[model samples]
Target chain A: MGTKAFWLATTAAVLIVFAASRLVTNDYVFFAGYVVLQYVVLATAWNILGGYAGYINFGTSGFVGIGAYSTVVLHKLVGPPIPVLILVGGIVSGAIGLGMGYLTLRLRGVYFGIATLAMAIVVQTLVTNWDFVGGSRGVYIIRPAHVPFIGGYIQYLFLVMLVLAAVAVAAARTIERSVFGFGLAAIRDDEQAAEVSGVPTLRLKLIAISVSCGLMGMAGAPLPYYVTYLDPASAFNLGYTANTIAMPLIGGTASWVGPVIGAIGLATIQQVSTVTISSALNLLIVGVLLLICVVVAPNGIVGLVRGKRRRAGRGG
Target chain B: MADDLLSVDKLGKRFGGFVALDGIDLTVRAGERLGLIGPNGSGKSTLVNCLSGTLRNDSGTVRFDGNLLNGLAAHRRTRLGLARSFQLPKPFRSLTVVENLRVPLYYSVNARPGAPHLAEAAVGERCRELLRLVGLEAKADRQPQDLTQIEMRKLELARALAAEPKLLIADEAMAGLSNSEVDNILALLMRLGDRGIAVILIEHIMRAVISFSQRLVVLVAGRKIADGDPHAVVRDPEVVRAYLGE
Candidate 1:
């Protein structure tokens, strides 16, 4: 789609979602919708570094957990507004991401991935020991009955997540179209070749990681308010890491639309299956779907569709 | 000496006590076509790597356009008008043929100082022109995987050319091509040289090297055995003994 049409379609989609949320009286839909939107943000964020640059970052939970804990600390210390807390969370995660990139981005392939995984463990340990943000025991967050402008607290949280998701998708789309995107694609194809082609690979990778981690943190900042509780275990949940990585991989890792499609599809399936079968089966479902996608459609749904169209064009 | 586009002095590299390039000195004047011929494991690739900043020398200086390039990274060197085509074609597999050229043009050429900023249309136009120069204009939209052996080599050269480099080191660019393909690549290298870009053609194909090179340098056992006119260098006793032992 053209840039103007894309924005028009996105704005219309956001409005439709907002209007639809107003018509529904049940709080369950908003709560479920919040989870899906949050995944959209996480998946898109991860795709920036992982999909575009071909740097597998296994530390989604670390950045998200940092954002969640940032919100908790801020809420306890000064009780800033949620938006302010989100911004603080993003800055904190972005800084950490930048530091991590500087230190570990020199390692390529699996070693770099292993470093990110280690980062998650280290963050989890630190959060576990810290008593201010509720240590291992966790802390309860008292929520007001309603937010001022938005009637219900859940509705307000859902709206925030929806906006964040839209912004992440838009940003990813912009990066995919820019010179920066081409550079990232070159890095993904071959880093040595990209460097020889005069691409500043290190700078681009740092930018990608910073943006990606910042978005993840932003998505996590409001989680304390959504869940009405926070702890190291829930905040640094492996589910966040698994789902964020799996969504983009299963949806398609190449484009902005891939993560969105993957997140919505996978999140809906998980939500439905959690209710129908058992909550324990959620991770199982994700694992199975990931495997199936890797084997059957390695390029994800978008790639599959494109491949079909190309084949049909040739045949005709 | 100051007019030399690339001057390497006392360049040395070692891999865990095994000397790869030892105390090598070389120079190429602006727009010169210098062929570098060496036996397998004779450190030709290593020398190219050092000159292109892909590998760092243990000692010595690589002065490119009179600037010291010892610690500079490969991409930095590329931005400063130095480029190389890999021995194996490393085209961006996901991008189309034209898009492959766009990477270097967008990054290297556009990044050059005092160069006019290229618009999207101008960039596209340059990409087509590069494809035509390499005789791959008809396959502009094709992927690298779809390219034939010669076409892949052409794309490799085209990618290096996109940098608008003052110096290009082509590492075995015509390795597996047929006779006509070898001549085709030699002609392309000559065309590039005519445009005032110094070229270091590292090849084992003596016929192509002899026909293309204005000067030839021979490396054997990580040491320069001969450096002079192509015919004189080939006829050197040391060069012949290194190649075909009597």
Candidate 2:
């Protein structure tokens, strides 16, 4: 489908889900649903560079941290609306992404992976030292008692995240089918071959990194409002890194739908397990699921299903 | 020299202390068919790399169609109409046979000034034509892994052709093929030459290179030892001593 049509359909679906959630009297659904939706955005954003271009980014939380801090700084200065804050977050993170790509894209394979991991640590250290966003002590956000139309602040946050998820998924789907996506796929398969074949490899990679980081930052922009107490440690939590990478790997990295499916499935499990058991086991569950994915479905759930279908077709 | 489509002046490359290509001077006229041959570890592949901008030459200059090609990136060189197939045939593993041709068409061909702005349908049409040219229309949807070794080589050649290049370098494109398969590739290279595309065929298969090349160039120990009529160059004493070993 064309991007416009896909976007319209996704928006319609999100609205319907939001409308259905309104029927539930309890506020807990929105609280948990917000997180699941947040991963949906994070996973989709990460996949743009990590899955599509075959560059593994271990610093997802760094981009998210940038977004959250950008929001914190903006709130301190002018206290802009969430949308404006989100825009600023995306732009700042995208510029950093472009800079990071320029400095590190020449290093491939494990070296590139290490550079991104180190980048996350660097970002965390920087945020810890910077006092504008309250340094290591953290900052508290007092949300308005009642949201304009959504009634509850939590519900409003949920609705915003839902919209962002729709936007992220629609964007990914569009890129997956475009000429630009084909160039990325070529780069992923073989950088040298792609270059000799006339693909502008470095330029395409930088664009991927910028877009991926921008969307990730957008996902993080609303975090301060959601949690009320935002710290450098929480903003740059390594859990964000693990979950974002896990979602795409578990769902399938080849297509846009893979990361969305992975995020929704994995995040929902994590939320349910958190309530029924303990939050400490959340990372354990992720590790186990990732292990399963690596062993049994190395290409993820989508790849497994596609393999079965192809085999059945051949059999027939 | 003015009519030369590609001119290399004293091209040199070294890997640490080992010289790969030393002051190699060569020229190809428009639509010319030239065969480059040498023993293992000689500089035939290295020369192709320098000309195609895969590896930068430490010294000397390369001019293609009156444009000085020094320090240009590989993709930029391709945009300027120099294309080459790898010796081992590096096909995009994830892309299907036909989509493999689309990369060059979308990037190199369409980027040129006054080139037709190909819509999706036009791109598909062009991809189909390329697949047919390389006799890969039957396997258009198959992954590169599913193709035989010879088929992979054909796909490589077809992908290079997709750029609409002025000059093409086919590096051992028929390495593992049977005699009939080698003849097929030779005929294909000859056909490319007929279309006003200068071709440099680098091959170890002596018979195919001699039958296909109007002129032959021999390299030995990082230096050009012979360049002349194919029959005459083969009989040069130094070429026979260094390469033919007869």
Candidate 3:
């Protein structure tokens, strides 16, 4: 489908999913579906830099750590009742993303990838050692007072994440249509040609990374509040980084629906596997999907569908 | 703006101790057609790289339209109306032919302050117009991989033209094309120059070089051997021995 039609359908689907989610009000269903939305937000955020711009960030976990910590610290002082806390997560993560991009944006391909991985390691290490937020022991989040009749606390978390997911997807769409988006696409194609075309490439790249990281951070911010717990290892869990990349890659990088499809599909598989099979096997499923996408359908599912349509269109 | 659009003073680039370009001084007046010809490792591409901001000069200054262009990034220089085509065509593989035009048109139009922004439809139309100029409009919706050698070269020219550049550096655009194809490309570059776009043609094809260039420059071992009339520069003993190898 074309971009405009795809967006309209996505909006309708989101509303249906949200309303349907409200029907299943148990703690488990609320928690599991909310987790999927979190993945959707994080994965789409990652795609802003990785998929559309062709910049692979292995430091996604590092940005998540920043987001989680920022939310934990802020909520501990005040409370989660303020809805603006969600946006704060994005802003904080985006700032760190800017710093990371400035230092590593010039690095490309694997060298840049390795540098970002190292950055994640560094952040994880620092947070682990720092005692202010419990260090190795982790931070304790006292879940804030929930206003009655706004549904249960878990439902509120779901809505917060749904809106965040919406913002992430909307933001990505806006960037994809803008002039800066064209510059990133050019940089992805040929840096030299882009430079001579007058793209202000570094500025554009930095902006993309910042926006991407900020959204990712916001995705993680509520985790500490929802769970009422935070530790360095869980907050900086490297698995989150891999999921962000694998989901988008499997869904199809650079397309509007790529990350969403990848996120929802992978999260469902993980949820089913966690219940019936083994929690450890969840990653294995994602890994297999990633490998299949890389080997057979490098463009991901959306790409496959679009390719088939185009081929059929041509044949007719 | 000065009558000369670009002036290079003692520009140089080095890979380790091996100098790729050395003390190359040159000037191109507005709307000039200049041919930069050299042998395989003679630094034609290097000069273009430095002029187009792909490489930072190890020493010296590059000024465009009386503004210092050295130290500015490549795209920024392009915004200042300096654009170059790659020796090998590198169109955005995922984008359609017409979409390729939007990149430079937006890059040039957005990076400047006074330039008006075109709507998406206008941008798409302008892209088609550029493809038409280079005779690639019929294939506007096709991907770059769908293009043949001459068509790919045409796409590259269309992309460069989309920048609305004051000076366009066409880097070996006609290479690996048929003789008729070479003439077609020559006709296209001449048309661009006719529209008052300054052009620097880097080519190994001597026939095309002689026909397209109003002035010629020869580089050998990272240094300029001759810079003057195309006929004399090609015939000069040092230039002929070092650059032309005839």
Candidate 4:
């Protein structure tokens, strides 16, 4: 691992250890932290291609659902533990992403966006009708049959997610600065111009889709173990889609930390607001916030901050 | 004949029954500077699009550096050392001037096996050199939105140069520039050509066309009406009829 990767991994290790200790010490904290961190993983995964390459992927739930459903099916079939199941989910979802790219990456802008959204809907409908994973009724993992000595499974699960989230972030930044990163950025800026400049548009896009979906699969694989239950509605929820995309947009889609900050901020806000407001209106709040961000600070919080700092230095 | 560096033979293109480019034929030597010009909608840009692989030629072959370029994607054509500038500049709006150049420099240079791979700092240095070449180094950190029309044109040239192309087709590169600005762009194109990069200058500015072109080619209604010495091609009776209607 490079310096950035090493530090990120270390930070994730510390966070996981800290969260595990908290799980042992406080049940309420574990409940809250787990939910927020889950968003971080999904949002970070979405950021890899969406933020870096400027390719908007609204079908995030499709990949997540694939991960969750595959985890359940694989575990049921092969009897592997949770960790191995998540890896299976990642591979399956990545394959699906690769396939999806072939069908839709050539389309630009609204067309590409709608194609991904349609894909998510199709996957959701498929899982809802399939009875193997209990169809719409859902499946229960039964809490992984309870590992007796593990006093803080929730924390351990959270730690696992944290490591994944850090990996996602580091990987995203690395790709952003790497040769492929420049290629994607060029493709985003001007597809024709990028091509004319010798950027391999299709190859780069396929690679991005594969990696992006792989990360989403990893982010989602732990859900069966985390919730101890899975249903078509829960597994293929559009809520995941909204969180994965909106957080990146609200935080700054082009930067690594944009999705991280957006996920943590929005997740915590939604968590708190649910107590004082209606849970059903959470997405409504997010929708309104996204609109405001687009109009006022299209660059997101990071852009807003940088604009402020630049102004402040001039003023001083 | 060394197979000509680029051969566009019997190229035909159409947009839904409207013949945008009708049976065009042209060729360029390894380091020859050529100018292609026509009135608006005369198929110059369309030919550029077809030759560069942005649009596949309907009935022709575009062999670049001796490689057949039919049915290849646009970027693949670029990797074969063919690059073009748009009539309107299209810089990556979000990137700094240097970063915009880096995308092409990174792609074209690092993509080819034996080519040099520039680090970020080295890429920045090449970007600055390109900027200085076009007299836009002072605005390296500025966004495209911040550039004046002439500066934008220079930046466009700089972006194309980043690819280190064998043939650079500049489409109306001086379209909106002042007289002096036009001279600046013409000078820059000349400088690129002097570096042994064959150039295709597509311009309507008669002086820029005449002065910059070693040979002039004219198109009327998508057909090549004339291709010869600049002084004689413009005076050809058919070229006159096509231009001023005799």
Query: List-wise, what DockQ does each model earn?
Result: 0.86, 0.87, 0.76, 0.79
lDDT (Cα, tens digit) per residue for candidate 4, span A1-316:
5666767765866666675565467665666677787788788778777877778898998999999889888867876876787788899999999999999998888899999999989998998898888888889886643354555677667666766776777788778778788788878788888888888888999999999998888878888888887888888888999888899889988877788899989988888787678788789889998999999999999889988998898796
Model 2 C-alpha lDDT per residue in residues A1-316, reported as the tens digit of each score: 6667876778789879989988877889999999999999999999999899999999899999999999999999999999899899999999998999999998998898889889989999999999988999999998797888678888889989999998898888878888899999999999989998899999999999999999999999999999999999999999999999999999999999899899999999999999999999999999999999999999999999999999999996
Query: Global lDDT of each model?
Result: 0.93, 0.93, 0.84, 0.84
TM-score of chain B of each: 0.98, 0.98, 0.96, 0.96
| 10 residues in a row with least lDDT, candidate 1 chain A | A141-150
Q: Whose DockQ is higher: candidate 1's or candidate 2's?
A: 2
> For model 1, how many clashes?
0
**Which candidate comes out best when scored by TM-score?**
1
In candidate 3, stretches whose alpha carbon ends up further than 4 angstroms from where it belongs are: A1-15, A80-82, A144-146
TM-score of 3: 0.95
For candidate 2, the chain B TM-score comes to 0.98
Candidate 4, residues B62-179: lDDT per residue as tens digits?
A: 7899898999888777777888899999898878888888887878876777777787788778888898888887999888999998888888888888888999999999987889
Estimate the lDDT of model 4. Answer: 0.84
Looking at model 3, residue B85 earns an lDDT score of: 89
> Taking the candidates one at a time, how many backbone clashes does each contain?
0, 0, 3, 0
lDDT by residue (tens digit), candidate 1, B68-165: 99899889999998999999999999999999999998898898889898988999999989999999999999899999989999999999999989
Query: Candidate 3 at B241: error in angstroms?
Result: 2.3
Which parts of model 1 are misplaced by more than 4 Å?
A: none
Candidate 2, which segments miss by more than 4 Å at Cα?
A: A1-5
